[model samples]
Structure formats: C-alpha cells, structure tokens
Target: MNTSKQRPVRVAIIGLGWWGQKMVSILKSCGTELEIVCAVEPNPAAGDFCANNGLTLAASYDAALARADVDAVILATPHSLHPEQIDRGAAARKHIFCEKPLALTKADAERAVRLCREAGLVLGMGHERRFEPPIVDILQKASGGHLGRILQIEANFSHDKFMTLNKSNWRLDPQEAPVAGMTATGIHLTDLSVKLLGAAYDVRVSCETLASDFRQGDTFSAHVRFKGGGTAYVSATLVTPFVSRFAVFGTKGWIDVRDKAHVEAPAGWIITRASVGSLIEISEVGPAEPVRENLVAFARAVRDGRPYEISGEDLVNNIALLEAIIRSAASGEVVAVG
Candidate 1:
C-alpha cells in the first residue's frame, strides 16, 4: 500500500490491446495511487478509448518515453518487444512494469534486468498470481515448513479465450508465441513453480496442435526437475474450457487448489489439504483482484522505494526455464536449464 504523502506514479501504457485496455480499467478502479497519463497504441481506433479514459494518446513508444510527466511505463506489448522496451525505459530513467514472459530468451531477460539494475530503476513484473490470497497462503505454509520437504507440484491453466482471435494475430504467430499455450498461460504455472520450488534443472515438453488453428500448437505439457530436488508438471491448452488448478505435494502434507473462474474475473477457490495424521480439510477462498494488487505494489515501489515481490534472479530464472521449455518442445528431448 502507498502512503498518502507519496504522489501517484504517472504512467504511459504501451499498448491498447485487450490486456492493455484491461490494465487501464484496473488502474482506474485502483483510485488515485496510479495514474494513466498517456497511452501508446499504433491503432488509430484507440483514440476514442484514450479520450474516454482521459489519457493522452502518444503517436509512438518513443513519444511516450520522452514524456517528462510519465514517471513509469507499463508494457503490455508483445513478448519480443519486452527487452528493447525495458532498455529504452531504463535509458529514459523511468521505472518499468512489464507483462509476463518478459522475454522469449534468457539472454534478453538477463539484459533487461541488468539495464534496470544499472539505472537504479524499479523493474516490476506482471505475474499477478503471486499476489493471490490462496497462493500466498500456500507459499507461507510451504516456507514455514508446515508442508515439509516439498516433493512435487502439478498445475494447469487453460482457456478457450484465444480461439476467437484471427489466425494472423501475433499471438498465433510461431515466431512470436513459439510453443503452443506456453507463452500465454503455461508460463504463469512455471513462474509459480519457481516461486515455490526454486529454479529448475531441466525440462521435457510436448506441444501439439489439438483443436485450435494456432500454428505453434494449442496445448503443451512440461515436466520440470528442480535443482532443489523436486518436480513439477505444468501444462496449458488453448482450446479447453477455463480450468486453473495447482497442487503441491510434500512429505508432511499436500494442498490442492481449484479455481472456479479466471483471475481476471475471480469467483472463488476450493482448497483441499491433507496431512500425515490429520483428516483431509477443505476450505474456500473468496475472490480477489490480484491484478490490481500487483500493479499497486509496483506503483508503491516506484513511489516509496519499496521492494517488489519478484526478485531479478527469480525473473531471469523463470525465463531460463521458459527457454528450456521451448527447446524441449522443439527437439522432443529433455533440455537443461542454465
């Protein structure tokens, strides 16, 4: 939370696509702590959206970066553009909050982190699942040794939301999206795995086009081995009805969480737990606006020099695992993560 003494973080949103527009709506609902001063979208049709939202529509990303009033920039741009945009933001001396799958490659992710660190700028991520109440509870239990000797995790995040997208959309492009549903959905699972089980040592993945026209494939399943002696199975399918689940297994106890709706439209979560000498327990966690929580934390970091939840090392490690997932899917062999 930000103190009233601190001024709002004026931001220029770098895209006006579905997720970008969604960010605008979330920030508006977040009150005056985070202000959208401008927006950069190539599509001229977004002019009306900017006008209605009381935002200045910049002609280009460079124009937005050059704005003196813009204290930070939130990137909802394509995956390939993240590294360069982060570099530019650091050069402009503005704080940055980038959408997930920060970069498609490990080197680019590392470079983005380095540039931001060198410039003493806050680099925030779009992994909102970390802020979810249920996930936070799980993390606390695991770290407190209540779960005891973590063994494995299984997670799946799938939805048919992208099925209506045009075939030529960048999200469906092989060069842009790469492996199946990994970029759009599976990456979030992997990020959660890293947060719970530390870095991955290797991964084996299979990507197949089951029902969608996406050239890269509509589904992918990844088997990851963690360096800290645990395993994780993370998967996603673009053609499936909405499904989000995560289970953590440990020596003492295990927990299973099932979401009734997407994070953007949270309904509730069913959590089941079991322990060595106790009866299985089931509880329900109410809905939460994690996306707004994540963005507000980023704003607070920029305004008060507070630390963001995801560390730079964690950011790079997740991208490293993502790179391995892509390679394993391509070669039909297990790939090692560095």
Candidate 2:
C-alpha cells in the first residue's frame, strides 16, 4: 500500500438530493481523508445548503471537471445519467464514485467500467452494505466454510421512502427506474447475493404498482438461480415500512440478520446463527458508519493507492443481473444473465 497520505483527496460531489445530502453529511462527520472542494448541483435550492455547509457551489458538472483541484467526483445523480456522466468523468481524468445501480443496462455498465479502467482511474461504488459490521461478519463466515456448502439465500430491503415523491420524479420514471423497487432497494440485495452465492445464471421477476402512484411499479420480487448451484429469493416494496433482512442456508447450518433501521439511520443489527446439531445463537452488532467507511475507502484508493473493495467484475455482474430482472419483469418470463 502506498503510504504517502500527505494530503486529503479533494472531491466534487454532484447532485444535492436526499441521498446526496446524506453523503455530504457523512463525509463532513468522518471523512478526514477526503475534502469536499465543491458541490455541483444545478438546482438553485441547493445553493443555500452549500452556503450553510461552507462548500463552494459549482455552476455545473462541466465547471467542476474543469477545475484542477478536483481529483475525484461523487455521482449521486439520476440513474439514467450515470453512464454518460461516467464517460465524461473518465474523459476528464477524474476518479468516480457512483451511487447504486451503476447503469440501467449491461452494455452501459460495461462501457463505464471499461472507460474507468482505460483511464487508470479508481471506480468506486455505493454499495455500503458490504462495509456494515454484521454483513462483513456474515460474508466472512460464509467464505470461511462456517456455513458449509451454501444452498440458498433470502433477502428483503423494503421502505416507503419514495412513496411521497411526485409521479414526475426521476425515480418514479420508467425510463430511469424500471421494475419498481428494484433500483431503489432490491439492487442492494442482489449485490449481496452475488457476493454470497456467486454469478446469477437467470432470474424470474414480478412487479406491480400496488399502492404507490408511480406508473412503473411499487413492489417487486425475484427468484435468481446462480451458476454455482445456489438459488436466491429477493423482494422489495416501496409502500412498506422499513424492513431489511438477509438469510443464508447451507448444508451445515443457516445464518440470519435483521437491521433495526436503514443504513443511513444505523440503529444496530441482530444476527442469528444455527448449526445442524448445535443450538441457535443470537448476537447484536452496534451501529456503524458504513457510508463514511465506503467513501473513506474510495478516498484511500484515490490517494493512498489502496484497492477499493468493490471490484469491476462485481460492478458489471450486478448490472447484468439488474438488466435480467428488468427484462424478466417486463416479459413475465425467465431471463438469462450474462
């Protein structure tokens, strides 16, 4: 690892929406290795936020990229804009940390990964659940064979956070957020499932509007078959109360985790494990700053030459799985993942 940490990595944060503001708060709280040089938001309302936070407001993304002081950019923009913005950022020779669901399609995701790779810039992802304490422990146990031959996985990440958004919101637009809650909540579950179970071979999904006014849909459930012979069932609902749970079953035993609150709130986590012949055990994991940890890791990759935890393969595969889910939901048939 490169030990030259003489200066903090300066980054320009793009977008100042709810998640964007949350990221700004997280960085302000614990981002010692990172410096928020500027905030790029076209929305005039965000000007007050920048003023109060003492951050310079860039007139546009182009303006931010033109600055020599900005070493990286944190993209918290709309889903459809990711691919184009990534292309532009790479051309500007700026490292990028994009939010979830890198792109709406596999081809776009592949191009984004390729551009960042060719530019020799770090590509960071916003799947901060991997940095959560209980999640990290669960992955370690599964990888260490403590779970013994994984058979199946089940996960649900649901919330009503977007139910209040206007029907015209980009998040509710079919072009930007197809297949309902998949982009907002279910994608995180798929990312975790891919890590635990391996590459998904195919998927069958169902989506329905249910209670939300959004035209695309509000609820979705998917069944994924992994190439490694394991299967997973994942679901998310946009009209439900906060519910984040994950479970893995193996030939030897099973493990379950329940988060007391959302990743942003960080209440705590309850984990339970049971072996075939042993008693079930339950434990509690205290609240942690996973979002901050993820950004810090990204800054380290940019400044200290450390490898970011999320890999290029993981980024592309997750997007491929998402594409399959969207297709399956649309056709009401099983869709194969690349």
Candidate 3:
C-alpha cells in the first residue's frame, strides 16, 4: 500500500447540479487530500462561484479534460451522458468517479470500461449506496456466506417529484436521460440487489408512469432470479415520500438496511437477526466516515497504490444489468443480463 498520506489528489468537478454539488462539496471539504483542480459547469453562475472560491473554473468539461494539471475527474452528470463522458475522460487518461447508470446502452458501458482498462485508468461509477455503512455490512455478510446462501434481496427507493432527476431539469428530455427514470434509479437498485445476491441472472421487469407531468418512468418493479435459485426484488418510485430500504433474506437469517438522506449511518449498521427466544440486534459500524471514505478509496486507486476495495468489474456488471432492465421494460418482457 502506498503509505504516502501526504500525497494529495488533483480532481475536477463536472456539473454543479444537486448531486454535483455534493461531489463538489465533498472534494473541496476533503481537507488537503483532495485538491480542486478545476470546476467545469455549463452554468456560468456555478463556474464563477467555484472560481471565486479558489477553484480553477472551466467553461466546459472538454476544457478540463484537456488540462494535464488534473489527474482525476468526478462526473455527476445526467445518466444518458455518462457513456460519452466516461469514454472521453478515459481517453484523457483521468481516473474517474462517475454517477450511476454508466450508460444508456450496455455497449456504451462496455466500451467505456474497455477504454479505461486500456488507458490504465481507474473508472468508478458513483454507486455511492454501495459504500453506505449498513449496505456494506449486509453485502459483506452476504458474500461471506454468513447470510447462508442468500435466497432473496429487496431494494426500495422513493422520492417526491421534485427530487426526480429530470423533474425540473433537462433530464426530462428522453435523449438526455434515456431508459427514462430507470437509469435514474433502477440502475442503482438493480445493481445493488445483484451485488447482494452474488450474480445478476434472469430478470423480469415492469414499469409505469403514474404522473401525467412526469417525463419518463415513474415507478418500476423487477424480479431478478440469481444463481443457485436465489430471487431478488427491486423497485424505484418518484411519487412517494422519501424512503430507502434494502434487505437480504437468507436461509439462516436476514439483514436490513434503511436510510433517508444519509441513508446508512457512519456509526455502523443496525442489523437484525431472528432467533427462537428473541430477535438479536447487532450494531456494527465499520470505520467511521460516510461518502468521504469512498472518495478516499478512489484517491488511493488514482495514486496506483492499492486498488480501491471495489473494482471496475463490479461497475461494468451493474451497467449490464441496468441495460437489461431497460430492454425488459421497453420490450414488455424479461431480459437476460450477463
């Protein structure tokens, strides 16, 4: 491991939207470990603000990408644009931490991954939920077999219309947020379920747009059949009050993860296991830190030290499943994802 704790990472933040602000804030507030190389947002207001705050301001992402001063980029752009952004960033040989729904198509995702691999760059999707403390614990236990051959997993995410990715933004344009709202969330939920279930096998999905004003998919449900006959259920909605819940059901016991804004707490997971006489509650918060830890992991990988605990392969698979869900929804039938 590169114990060079003094080494700082030069990073640029693209897009200054809602989530983009979080990324920008996390990078800027990371003390000395994260150096703000540039701020690239089409919004002049945002760029001017970042520049006023001592960050190099770029008019566009391409300008930042062309700069050799930056070693990495955090892209919290919209979903449909992820593929092109990732590919272009990889070509520039910049380590990447991008938002979920890697691409509108699996082909684009595969291309982005291949390009990054060839460029010898780290390409991490912003599947931030995966790094949530409770979710991490649940996955660790599931992978360790402590969940006893996980039989089923459930994922839920609900947000009000105002919180929808495309609610008031350009994301409402199908071309900009393809696969509709599915990419906005199905990407995260399905990917999460697969991680806990071990593999994304067969998937049957259905979707509907409940709101007349909503641009794309409003709510979706998917039934995923994993290897070893395990089943996983996934769902996302834009009409409900905010509720985030994740659970894994195994032959021996089950694990549940729930959260709202921060989702899982940094302290640890509020884990529950059932027994004959009583229900056991285990609070296991592993290593304090929330979203920042994921950024640190990315920083370590960018330094070519130890690879981030999560690999690029896991990200690619998630995109694959994401593509299949869209296909299933589009075709009104089940779609298989490798």
Q: What lDDT, from 0 to 1, does candidate 3 have?
A: 0.71
List, residue by residue over 1-338, the lDDT tens digit for candidate 1: 22233578889999999899999999998786798889999988899998888888998999988888888999999999998999889998989999998999899999999998988888999999888888888889999999999999999999999899988788888888988889998888899899888999999999999786789999989999999899999999999899999999999999999998988788989999999999999999998999999999998888878889999999999999999998999998999997
Better of 1 and 3 by TM-score: 1
What C-alpha lDDT values do all the predictions have?
A: 0.90, 0.90, 0.71
Superposed by TM-score, candidate 1 places the C-alpha of residue 14 at a distance from the truth, in angstroms, of 0.5
- For each candidate, give its TM-score against the true structure: 0.97, 0.97, 0.88
Better of 1 and 3 by lDDT: 1
Worst 10 residues of 2 by lDDT: 1-10
Give per-residue lDDT, candidate 1, residue 47: 96
Give per-model CA RMSD. Answer: 1.9, 1.6, 3.3
**Residue range 1-338, candidate 3, lDDT tens digits:** 12245668788888887777767667766776678788888776786577667777786889998887788888878776777788788777788887777776667877887888788787766777777777777778777777676777787777674454445586566556544456666577777766665557778888787764665667778888866577878887767776776787877678776663433333444455553345766554444455677787788777746676655566667777776777787787878886
